[model samples]
Every structure is written in C-alpha cells, then in structure tokens.
Target: MIVNLGDQLFMQLQLRGTIWTQTITNLRTNWAVNFSIDLLGQSQNYLYFRIEQYGSTFVDDAVYLNSKWKFARPSNQGCTLAFRGIKDFVSTPQLSADGLSCSVVKIIQRAKENPRPGF
Candidate 1:
C-alpha cells in the first residue's frame, strides 16, 4: 500500500534524527573530533598541507614558529593561536620552505614537543 506524503516525510525525519544522534554521541565520546582548524595559505597559492593527522587532532592549523623567537604566550593581550607564527610570512609573502620547518605538521608537532625540540 502507498503511504501518505506526511508519513514519508516523518520517516525521513526519523532517519535523519538517528544519524544526527549518532554523530553527536560520537563527537562527545571522542575529544579528538571536537575542534576546528584554520588553514593559512601562503603566497604563490601553494597547497602544502601535511595531508595527514596532526597529533590526535583531526584538521591542522597553519602556525609559523621561529627557531629564535619561540615561546609564544597566547594568554597575553591580543595574542592568540592565530599569531603563534605570525611574523613568518606576513611582511613578505613567500613559498613555504621545508628547510625552516614551514609546513603545518612541523609547527603543530613542535608545539606538542616543546621541551625536547631536537627530538
């Protein structure tokens, strides 16, 4: 027997609710998935993302840290994660150089392993 349009719409809503419930539950159980990423595209429009997970976090943010000017105090006024590595390519746009660990993966990894930078 053919069902009424209202019944079909209700069934669709039920299916959607089930999917939404599962998604919310998964997100709550997994802290790794409950975060955001900000991609900072460099000059020349070169896309050089690690194309992989950075630590336990899902998406990675592009932060530029300097070997000399390390120690970024994000708690300071006007300081934030966005400015962790701000001075790198802001003054002059240039292609990311692997020699200086300009990739997103390296920057994030460095943050996790701050003390033992040589490691």
Candidate 2:
C-alpha cells in the first residue's frame, strides 16, 4: 500500500513480521530506491538500500539520518546503504540504528495537514 508522507511524498513498504522490504521510485526522474530490513536470524536488524538511475547503478553522496537530516556515507563499492548501529541498539525507542526510524524517516518541523500513515 502507498503510505502517504504528507502530500506529494509517499512510501511503499512491506513487512512480514520481522522481515520487511521497501521500494520508492521517483516518477519524475530515473531514480529507483530500494531498501530491506532483516530483523531475524544472523542478519538481524540489518538495514540496507540500493539506488539505480536509468537502470544503471549510481553512487552519490551520503544518505539522510538523524533528526537534523545529517548525511551518512554509503559504501565505496556502490550505493550500498548500510547502517552501523546494531552494536549499540538497546531495547528502547530512543535509539535508532541509522539515526532514522520507521515512523519518521524524515522529520518535519512544521505541522502536517495530511493524516499520518497507518497499517
């Protein structure tokens, strides 16, 4: 389902219990973004993302994380988005693996007129 992110922006996510995947493509551009999170087995809580442009792999700048939308560098091999915070993940909602959360990927300072996305 299309999880509306306010007005123009939205995300499509699929979750099967502890494992999930998401794909977000830019309709106006050739950018295709894909991400997956595995919260089970050895790859537990591992978050990864890949980007493609014009059907070709493209490695650009850092991805957004943190509350202020800070930049987090990707791997040098390609646009491999990896989170390096599993070592410090406590059983709490205050900490984020990639300085990001499922509820609020991009924090908004202003009020949203649109309703929040739900299951």
Question: What's the TM-score of each model vs. the native?
Answer: 0.14, 0.27
lDDT of each: 0.24, 0.35
> Taking the tens digit of each residue's C-alpha lDDT, what string does model 1 give over 3-30?
2222211110112222311111122233
Q: So what's the TM-score on candidate 1?
A: 0.14
**Who wins the TM-score comparison?**
2
Which candidate ranks first by lDDT, i.e. highest?
2
How many clashing pairs does model 2 include? 0
Off by over 4 Å in 2: 1-8, 41-119
The number of clashing residue pairs in model 1 is 1
